[model samples]
Target: EDVHIRREVNALYVYAFCLPSCREYLSGSKGEGFLFPWSDLDIMVSKLPPEEISMESFHNDCAYIATTNGCKPGFCKLIQSYAKCDYYSRVEFLQLKQHAGFNVNFDQTIRGPCYSTNFPDGFDCCYALPVHPDSSNVFLRTFKTKFWNGVKLEIMNKNITVMHCVPKGPEKGDDDGHQWLISFSILEQNIVHSLNHVQF
Candidate 1:
């Protein structure tokens, strides 16, 4: 249990110091503090280009609007109101630029929404964009479930802002390239941290 907690703390420290202010997160087994011999790192990067603005900000040609019109539950299609440029449209380009400084050779094959490395101690990196839950009624409805009954209001307020829209995984349809999965990584991390030793 001590080792588990230590691992989580170490990951947070590394990310807080080494990463930029783009809200990069350590996720998967390592972030949950259950590292096994085969465990690999999972990183989620939620940063927009310098020219872009968040959904709550001004809606310009660079803005991506999340719409659930034809997607499955917990997923939405990112529709750009106007295409002034292909910067955000080309997901691969954005991902490559984001990890350029890592100096690691990523595997040629794309794995779901991540760009993975082939080494034994490799990591899976994914790019995402932030979306405020209060910006859409769909998100508000999803959060008003019976599951949140006993949860503290403060925790909800703190974690909900961390919600993100990740690129759709390969398991979905071809049109998935334009789709985004709603992620609650921060909320999940908090819940894991709150678990008792036995529960963990």
Candidate 2:
């Protein structure tokens, strides 16, 4: 688990360097060392663009963004499908996607990672999953298998861990009071990391 966290930390740092406007730090229960075997890796990124402008290396950032967006379609379906499942439910489909390098996370009850920058008023947060070119091609193949009654018959991956979060309360309800509020896990992480060491 520590190894995975280190890898995730390095990945986020590398990706953050690609985006000059962004500064990120580890955040979440895992960031706070309060995670169990099953916890999502969280990294909080704040946008802080530098004042100076340089035209010489602008294409690299553009290319990096393009590559990140050009992920396989199965990856999208896997996230969407898993997200729709119970946030803590051990859907076998999730295990497969995790092996495929998809980070199983949550944004409210969405059951997946938050990757959008354009949000409505009073809500603005964005995160991008870092991809490795050398990782095995597990994403495309996950589409071939079908889940049965919210379960899979195949053998589960033992290496895969499950992280659970506290249940959403009534105060977290949306404007319609039907949906749970969006996750502030990232924000919470920032708060956790910024605390005074001895006092906290």
Q: How close is candidate 2 to the true structure, as a TM-score?
A: 0.25
The Cα RMSD in angstroms, rounded to one decimal, for candidate 2 relative to the true structure is 20.7
Minimum summed lDDT over a 10-residue window in model 1 is located at 48-57
lDDT, candidate 2, at 51:
18
- TM-score for every candidate vs. truth? 0.69, 0.25
RMSD (Å) of each candidate, 1 decimal: 4.5, 20.7
lDDT of 2 at 188: 37
The TM-score leader among the candidates is 1
Clashing residue pairs in candidate 2 are 38-162, 38-163, 39-163
Query: What is model 1's C-alpha RMSD?
Result: 4.5
Query: How well does model 1 score by local distance difference test?
Result: 0.60
